[model samples]
Target: MIIRSALTRSLIPEFLTGAGRNQREIASALSSSRREFLRNTAGLVLGSTLSGASPFLRGESVRKKRKVIVVTFGGGARDQETFAPEGQENIPHLLNELVPQSSFFTHVSNQGILGHYVATASLTTGVYETLNNFSAVAPEHPTVFEYFRKDLKRPASDAWVVAPSNGFNRIGESECRSYGPGTGATVILPKHLLAAATSGGAADFDHLLRDNYENPLYTPQLGGGEFELQQLDGILRLSVADFMAHARTLSSPDELSIYIAKRLMQQEAPSLLWITMHDIDVAHSGAYSLYIEGIRRTDRLCTELWNAVQANPEYAGNTTLFILPDFGRDSDYDAGGNGFQHHRTGDVASRTTWMMALGAGVREGVIFNDPMQSIDLVPSLGAIMGFSPAQSQGKPIKDLL
Candidate 1:
């Protein structure tokens, strides 16, 4: 399924050919008016691994057919509580179990909005989107998922975004006129889905707390077409009982995401998956102990995710894993903002994070000390998966390519 350079331009769909060519031509020549432009491109819905025996461990030529999983240490974590010398104790699994086996980047900067929704949008799109940080809106540009799906002609199940934040419901898609929902990722927000399933009176304080963190929006139900039903039946059938069990575990959002991730990889072996964890944002409570506990929990969940990848034969030896924080927190004593309480100060601590890449096609035991932008992840992923994200502003990470 890897559409390498050998796939000639003539074979690519008109919507996916050339660098930004599709969007530009459609925007300019297709319609004379704005409303007409949208109507004209309405049909262009971006309509959008694993396993196997021991062929990979046997060093067979299965490298070209790799899958990718991106685990974001989201909700803005600082190095002080996760990766620095003093913070090592809080993430023993990462430092002791995962770091040594991966290629680590010491300095990754996010030079854009520090809010969770906006920051993650920037990360996913490789563009610094300036949208309202708290709104339930999609990015203005096409996501990496859109690029991969449109080019590969993969099913919607092949690209996914497993998030806990309701504000990110649209993160799987975009508002871009050319490539929209038709080619967006299949988004799953665990907490929101659970809330939607739970009866109002039966919901407890824990459920209420989650609801407050991310209020689920209700839309009128619309019957799905035959194609939609066929494509989504399996995911829609996820058991409420199983979801509740995981929701009660340590770091509800993070753990639940990992649990669902395991199931997704097992059932579909998606070509691209993005998982975002948010417990660490509890630091905003300004409680040092709680923040550290969140860090420790995040560390554990990360290890669990890595373990899932290794244990799932569909993903085991032929998957690449990228883990990094969306952004950082203010320095402890900075006059701008208190430590671990704010990421809006634009301080080095708030903007600088780290990245780790492991598994297939990743160089082991290597450390990249040079500074790199956070947006670089999108294109680097493109290079690995064999497609160019036509609208991405960031260049691929040369080392990874």
Candidate 2:
């Protein structure tokens, strides 16, 4: 199914180019309700234009393979809370700092399942994935990780996924018939490791036995933690004391993930690393203050992640960073739900999101008024890293390619 709606393509450019009246004026004209109008227009445009059709190669040759980092603004966020003119106060670092150096896509559409795990699976695979959102199962198609590592013959240490979503343990690999686990990305669920380390959790021992003892009659259901640990037997793990000593001052699963990510950068510095931030999903609690706090904190964490990249010699001059929310939230006045509680509305607001691409091989300060899909990320990443996933249905982003 096509993920981008025609309204997304037709109106966002008009909003940015001032072809119509000002954004608020145009939004007013589109929907009688201000809330519904802002929801549709917020992520679509910011006026800055693409330099030309061949922007990527205006004055240079194809760039060398570069380090790539994709940060999924994994829970839902909305224009009222993020990129809208009034909403700009919440994301100072992004607007004041990163937007100036990044090629920002004001409108990004996610046309598939809105659940976090499945949406992320679609993002990494570039295919519309049909999978149980709450289940710990992997996608049915090959992921960018498999394509990059298998084709480049990169070592296991060269591709990584660090996430806090316990349900996302299987995101590192896919159940594709070919090029499967042998080339899956190395994944680190920081919270699980920390819990394992601190509690002497037998989750690990149980998973180890489960994988070895499986048979048709005796097979049992496993959660993401167990499912992930079973596949990661060879990776060295830290002792409770060791992890505590290393992270005595850190708290929250989000901070722990960031800590491990920086540590990974300091040591192995993988060529491709995708970090999923889940704190923003706290909105499920229905607390507006906590929800806003999550957005503010995510902004800070993203800045920290980018700063880590700039400081690391391995990632420093040659790395590219891509950031986007997995999807957006329902409108406050929408009939289905209220106040960012869920992403099931199927409204224009829920499927519409934004993206930012910065660092090496990106056009600085260009806010393209293009409406693109979440699946487009994989091919754009492939362009930078030098290999295309055989099953990706989306095309490479035009401006980036």
Candidate 3:
């Protein structure tokens, strides 16, 4: 008899056995084996074909149903600028208009290294980073995505990350990639398609087919056309060939990404979806007037996304939208006059961020006064989605629930 390897055994915990006279010994044994089991179970749990077989795949009863949409206001904006009444007119649409109808967190703050990756990691994983750098690793705890996907037995591809730029390329090992129990596939910035199209590369169906053949995993689904395959390849080139054929009809890259997200929602919308808008970040190249214009465009994008969610049958009435920045720029009070230029040094303004929530299960027009950290988002999201916290460092905001 050939026993399964340790790695294999680690993934499937149901195969383990324990014997003890009392509860403590049994519990200890189970704990030791649990991590290994979950690790070994990844392949089967995240396998594309087996997605529908999971118990949690069954849609929730109408009364218990809820959806979660997390939007990173990538590239930070100051509270004084966005929500604080001091500069309320700067972001009039978001502040005076949106805040009144949605729940606002007046005391909310981000307590990380005051960097993009660090704050985003804290927001999703509910832990502070020891370092404030780009390549920083996400904490080794289950994220809001993992809690919903694994504990709830939802499909692996149900979770989504739609970024206009490379905003969410590092959500986590498990959250960013298709692995482990309840891990879902991610969609990254596929700017390559635009590059290819603009660079005079062939955009015809034949060229895409050839590319697919060279990589068998890229083979298009029966009904999905070549353009769809190209779009899927642009973001996730492996393990998602089934979505390619439908990509042809998308008019633009943004539209293509949103279409794909909507498709995933209809197929089996993972309980958790993260969307990042980065058009404004590109506008910060020393053009003050252009930067303000970018802000307006970002506002419109938010409105468009909200409209899409409302109009889309799959997400309407069932989703919760949480939007906030990843980090903020330097204070204009600096002597060197590096206003709105960078976020290098840690400052009071740089660490400050904002949050807003609307939709199912969230109290409308409520404002939370207690200070909350970005790490708190994961647990709060988990509680709202009917799951227990999974070894997170932050506490859930009871006010949000």
Candidate 4:
């Protein structure tokens, strides 16, 4: 049976009455609550924030050895289950380990479609891409992977995306003429990889292969150039038997994705790596307990990924790690919604999210309450990696660069 969380725990119940107010107003209030929560619990300092300036004036040598790993919560969890006091118990690692050594952004909003694919696509392209969320089409603009590789002259293996679902297969590249197919990142779909590796005996590993939480029947046709089963053995050096054997020990798809991603780090050490975590999105099933479990798992997995970066020679002391949700869940403020179970309503609780940046030049224990949009990510990445996002509309988050 699906257990439901109390309304008061989701968002400030009093604030729900102001649902008709301007969106910016609600977003500001949401940010303020998170700002205060972090200030009191995480003990983060409210210091420098986003300046929107390019990194042209900064030292260029720093970009040469820099490695970036992005962890995006594609199935956004609300504050009640994450950063708030009621939710703090679910994210002990984030509060105790990660947040203390990071620059946290309290007010990151997603002003695009609430669908995970489109919102994440908008983040990758930094253009608020209008492509259908459920469609197999690529982003209309150049992806950050393209900008990084085309401008920095990096090889295909130097940029990679370990996505959670098969629908994200095209996210590695875009249709832009300036930077087409060959210049983008190499996409790795962990579920698809597992499916291919265990074609006939899928039932035993069904728990690890659950795709698209919201639409279970809608598996979009995966594109070409994805990480193949043959490449898994040749590149990751894990035989099908070994991969399947180890996968049987895992609990969720996110764990499998991290397993593949960590293998990529050890084997390839991609300069630009992106990992999309969607296990938290299982809330669509209306199980509050499962949603919270996903949050706890994500919290621990995040620490695991960061620890891997520190332990690896290529990423140690030179990598910058970013963790943020692609968007957030709905609250009682949206009448058309089911609260924490879905993001159908693009209300403040659904659109407003947060981010944390750690390692390399990041300011330790700093918190920024300034408002920023999801689209700002690509341009910020371009600025950090010494690339020009010619078509990206969002500005570079200077605080991070």
Candidate 5:
């Protein structure tokens, strides 16, 4: 249903009929596969059924109290393990509950480093940041947090991030001129908090304390700007003993993150909240069963977060929730890649992914296959929330606005 330009339409058939598969051909084929799978399995309507953009988009008065929650897939997941016929059984919540209420985009591509930290940094900044994936350096461009805070004249408490690693400490802010410290979101590392709360008695909690599944040899220094141990009592209103006692009941780090995010909603209720789920990154351990387990756990945790949004009066009716992966894992077709183990191959499968947007100001049960990039997220958010991403290399998507 994509209306290609005359020249592009003519060129596509030649590439499709060509002997070797090009990047565009691979991406288009993957998108078409996902589109057909969701349509048949989830009973979603094609976006072509809609007339134009969504009608729920309102004015600044309504947007003043609007909330946005972004959940990212830190580890790569492939179609065969997620949306395909063989993998559909693993994500029952997304297929049966969420996708029917979401505007699904099947052709989102990431044109940046495939590492979790750097890729997520690009997602926040709307720029392809080249900083070391394992380092503690901040992004070179301004983040969406800074724009949302500075332009909207909101305070630090209004924007917050709950990420999975020490590498994300600087992700809440950027070192860009005129938009640096104090003008961004405050990051909360749940594993780091648990480590401090247990105070060297964390041997029983090593499974929940796993950090940066991609690399265990390098631990970055704890940067000072993030949420610290002392503030846990003052901010989240939970004492160290109670927090650790609750942590004893959780199975994964993403669950702990969800627990913290729910408290944040009930306590501070920030207007902008970003949570990165890293459990799926356990694939780097080369255990296929564990990787599948991570996916199922993430699926349940995502629904829990959405339910929390609906249960809270401050966020229930006005919040827009977006769920997508930072990128995808390698394909079994690639000879150089080990299927689903790691994202180091950076193949076409690794670059192509999907996104779902649902809630206020969004169309439901429609699938759009229009090609987009990970960087476009910031501009789309800016347009919806009434801010300007001055240096972003992407444009706002009109379908949501």
Candidate 6:
């Protein structure tokens, strides 16, 4: 099966160019002193490696690697609005319905900057970000992607990150190169790219932006060269066609990501995958009812993903799916309210989160009450993938085993 969907390819140029330039500018700005420059350069290199670096570079064999799917419930959400008993009505499908069938954690907290990207970084790196606001600096510590790809020597293509929020575009690439060699981590956002590729006049947007490269239309300018654009065009053509065709069968964007993910599993069969669904967080758009609808849609998407995994041989019995939010939002009764507003100021309810795991080798009907942190996921996933955690602060949640 050809894994290079037109949409995936078409977006590559834009994705790579944009991401590469961001790193380059960040590196140059911080390059005044050699020591600090090297540090920043290391971050840039690691980030690129995470984007598309291959695992063979690290001397690791790739055969029959266990498959993992991590779903991020991004944009802080309160427990009361989700799994918590009081807010159960708000998320009927998830809280009241999707109970602790597999290993489930109720008191999961993220002690970090309480913002979306910061919490997300902490979740994967197991280290808190000092600044709560937007961070340009990558995590100093290695991420789960690095450990799995380098330490385990898995294929770089075997890992992926798909987030709806453009804010997480730098996730895998940030701490990617700490492993020293051979890592196959590829972060992608099919929905974003698809929307950009299929939207009316996107080509015009690209053309106009190219017309004035010096004064780029967006915050980050695209770089590389014509070769990049050609390669990107080819990729986008294929990805767009596939996505448009798939849209007929899938109604929601979450479903589209899942469909693409399954396609990736069947074709590339990556050992680890991260998929984020963001409509719920669109609550910031000031549409509480729409946010709730997004939650319901997410619930349906989860069920569909579960069903798809069971039916697909690549994932079936060999895969484990861990689902949780990047961070929780404030309670409706609290300062920000739950519908569709900001989550950065740090509300007690926003820190509350939960996790669910299901699949082979995982205990079923297990409920964990102990206080757990998002950082713990990395170590637990590492252990599950048959590797020892290296200098990881997070502990493995033994109950899952």
lDDT of 2 by residue, 103-208 (tens): 7776677889988888899998999898987777888889999998887788888889987765677888887776776577877777566555545444433321
List per-prediction Cα lDDT, in the order shown: 0.66, 0.69, 0.51, 0.86, 0.87, 0.55
Pairs with backbone N, CA or C atoms under 3 Å apart (clashes), candidate 4: none
Ranking by TM-score: 5, 4, 2, 1, 6, 3
lDDT of 3 at 126: 78
Regions more than 4 Å wrong, model 6:
1-65, 84-100, 131-137, 175-184, 199-239, 245-253, 335-340
Across 65-122, the per-residue lDDT of candidate 5 in tens digits comes to 9999999965868887787666777788888889899999999999999989999999
**Model 3: per-residue lDDT, tens digit, 1-401?**
11246443331122212222243332233323322222232211211112122112223574246678887765665433343333334565554445444665544556567655456656767777553243423345556666676666766555666644333344533434443333643544433333333342336432222221112233221121112334544434423434444445433334444554555555555557787644344324655554455455555456666677888777788878888777666656545436565665554455555577877655555544455677888888776676766667888876665
Per-model TM values vs. the true structure:
0.78, 0.79, 0.65, 0.94, 0.94, 0.70
Query: Between 3 and 4, whose lDDT is larger?
Result: 4
RMSD of each: 15.9, 8.6, 19.1, 3.9, 5.1, 16.5
Per-residue lDDT over 146-179 for candidate 4, one digit per residue giving the tens place of the 0 to 100 score: 9998888999989999999888888888978878
Query: Which candidate, 5 or 6, has the higher lDDT?
Result: 5
1-401 in candidate 6: lDDT tens per residue? 11223322222123223433553332222122211211221221211122232221112222243678888864545442444233334554443334434556655667777666667777777777553334334555666787777766666666776655434555664434455223435555554455455563243233111211111232322221111212223433345555555555654556656766666666667778888776666567667676676676777677677777888877787778888988766544444444236575454445656687777655554455556677888888876676665756888875554
What residue runs in model 2 are displaced by over 4 Å at the alpha carbon? 1-65, 200-239, 246-248
Q: Backbone clashes in each candidate structure, one number apiece?
A: 8, 1, 18, 0, 0, 24
TM-score, candidate 4, is: 0.94
Q: Could you tell me which 10 consecutive residues in candidate 1 have the lowest summed lDDT?
A: 42-51
Candidate 5: where is the Cα deviation over 4 Å? Answer: 1-19
Q: RMSD to the native, candidate 4?
A: 3.9
TM accuracy, model 5:
0.94
lDDT of 1 by residue, 47-158 (tens): 0011222212322245345789998896767654554334556787876677767767656777888888788989999998898876767799889998888876778878
| Residue 164, candidate 4: alpha-carbon lDDT | 92
Task: Answer with 2 or 4, whichever has the higher lDDT.
Answer: 4
